[model samples]
Target: MEKLFELSHQNPALFVDILESIKDAIFISDHEGTTLWLNSASEAMCGVPKNKITGRNVRDLEKEGLFKPSVLRMALEEGKNVSTVQTVGEGRKYIATGHLVKNKEGKVIAAVAHLRDITDAVKNTSKLQEIEELLEKYSAQIRKLTSTKTNINGVENVKLGGKSNSRILAKKIIEKIAAVDTTALIVGETGTGKSLAAEKIHLLSKRRNGPFVQINCASLPESLLESELFGYEKGSFTGATSKGKTGLIKAAEAGTLFLDEIGEVPLHLQTKILHFLQSKTYMPIGAREPRNADVRIIAATNRDLEQMVEEGTFRSDLFYRLNILTVKIPSLRESRDDIEDLATYFLNMFNEKYNKNKRFSNEVLKKLIQYSWPGNIRELENLIERLVILSEDEFIEEKDLPQKMVEQHMSSNSPYISDRGTMTEILEEMEKKMIIDALEKENSTRKAAKFLGVSQSLLMRRIKKYNIQLVVEESKTFVK
Candidate 1:
């Protein structure tokens, strides 16, 4: 013990000098966020000697213009570590990260903070991001040109709506997962363009040159569907072809096989699909051995598979297998911001197809926006085609629109959405209320996360951000 004490005395600057020599600013504050100690670097960065700032409240430093808002004060208020950006002397940007200093008894005693100068790094990052954004835009244009030049069906028209957040999210999800060979399940209401999305994915994938095989499970009965998928040997069934035929799985070798209306697949076939997904092998009828194929599965369904699983109609294992890389597309009614753009696009497309020139009047376009499109994009496309063919006048007037559309347009104005500046403020207040309500209903962060479809850590961040009051202590136990 005496030898260790001598060594520590010989190298006391190892601790103090190192903290003083580091570039980042460092400081410590008490439970009340009163500055207790400030290292030499922090003192230099703030341009105030430690003797002047120590023993003073951190919030007071903000008032004195030593720095911007105090991250240490925020950490103390939130009872957790906090990070924020601050502008210091000479308009330089610094990133401050606050840590919650806990005692041996597991109670927070003080907060420590480290501030890093990031102005130059931030500028470089911004420039790099701008370059990347330009590259992404041109790459998309190139892909679109190729699709058009090659006359790719279904993919040429498949686009994420510009104005709808839901559609934007779906497009991002698709783009992110397309790089990997993961089984994808697309869920949406009928006519919501699930098949179009599948075609676009295949076109955008690494296997774009390979064939895209498609089939609708709902159009075939169990026996026929099975035989069609796993093509049989000659005389395997009553109407079998004289020569042995290849299955869709085999036909889509080294490509993508789209199974539309996947929910309609029978339970007996579900087992076969699961086996193939697990091992990429399927047995044909009247065949002694199984066949292996290299096909990527992209399944789409308009039904609730979870409900079907609970009712024992769908196998839980198959549901889990298909549920990877899920994407839920919004219905047309939920995408009001996209109505005008879609209507114009469809008008131009059908005009070219039918060799007619027809335009919608402003009033008719307004009516179209207000109408609740229960039949979704398919219905909209069909209606556009009909309007192009049936309307004798060059411009389709409001009177020509369906009667239901006019009635709905007159009553669709929402009362709560005026004054753009106030919208975010109102939404923030509502978000706070919702978090409190969800926490009350569930009494646990795990349930709250599930209810909100967000990570528990994010929920905790929001809780601290809002300083939400609670009736009971937050259930500290987390599920994952």
Candidate 2:
């Protein structure tokens, strides 16, 4: 058989080609650590050319805090084979194998090292770790659900679900009159958790153990509302019950009465309410006797009741009576800083409620913050619940958001949705543009895939299908 050195020297190109085809970087160095030969893979691994690497000591090209000199010294002086795994340049992982090369005389002559890129393996491991963590979280949440019962009365001392400022203000207002019997009027836009604030106020009050009666003035007609608020004697009206009916005011004796949509009360009923507020006395329908109510009233309205009073739609006297202590709830957009905390809170809440352990991706969180929540906290809570129920994965990605929200993000500057094109076409165009922009921003197909929440192969196919151009000029500018 021909000697191995003689064969390699004679067929250097063939040997080099074989090394290049092996995928792993292969490098040969002398006993003194001088590089002898390196393949194309080695050149790529070191970010240097094979010609430049040859005849140079590997230690001399050492980048501090990355590859250590001791690794090289052990491979050379100790004549021992060594292997190490290291992370290089941002998040790429490499597995390096070092072997002592021996001459025909059975003595060490040089060292050969091979490095394989294990970045994908490392990423999959990280993904597995994340999945394990999510599973553990799900398990813990399930255990809690099985062991604990949900509090139907809702959160205590905190607004049920709304902007942080509104919740804070509501808490403060609740704390202020928690020990007092003064009436409170909570005013805000619809779905701003006004009723929730009233409940919190009641829950924190001294009469919490007593019955809590809730009545909506707008839910019933003026005549029915009167009968509902005040008890009716037997045979008070044609459809009256055979037995006497107790009113909500009487039912809430020594307790709290939540009057929702209080502005909907008619003028005559407002007069009766004003009288009740002043004298704490009320009379049942068809009864020849007066009754005293020991109830604490908490009223809520989404209307500008003061304006209604000016327009003669509401009574100013009733407004003043209910507005003994007013708490104004702020809108969602006014408290943009609290969006993240609210989102997380709702995510966790639904995660436990539904037995799902879904997490919001950072991109989704960013989009949530960027959105102009016109429906305020209520809209956000509903959106989160929808995502939790609909999403299949453990993570709620940007794609999981409502299409309108995604469109709003893309057309942040566009005034109107283009009418010429179909909605599907518009959405496709938006997706293409967003994918291209993400690719341009990241400058890597892999990173772009992550940002777009798609697989690398899928992203590559889209890049080709959309004919998207990489911003080479922008990349050059970044390098500079």
- Tens digit of lDDT per residue, candidate 1, span 117-208? 99999888777666545644643443243222221554555565545888888888887667778789999987778987787788778867
**What is the number of backbone collisions in each predicted candidate, taken in the order shown?**
0, 0
Error of 1 at 195 (Å): 0.4
Q: What is the C-alpha RMSD of each candidate to the true structure, in Å?
A: 27.7, 29.9
The runs of at least 3 residues in candidate 2 whose Cα sits more than 4 Å from the true structure, single-residue gaps closed, are 1-166, 239-241, 416-480
lDDT at 156, model 1: 54
Q: Would you list the C-alpha lDDT of every candidate in the order shown?
A: 0.77, 0.73
**Per-residue alpha-carbon lDDT of model 2 for 259-325, expressed as tens digits?**
8888888999988888888889998888897898898888888789989999998888888888889
Q: Which stretch of 10 consecutive residues in model 1 shows the poorest summed lDDT?
A: 142-151
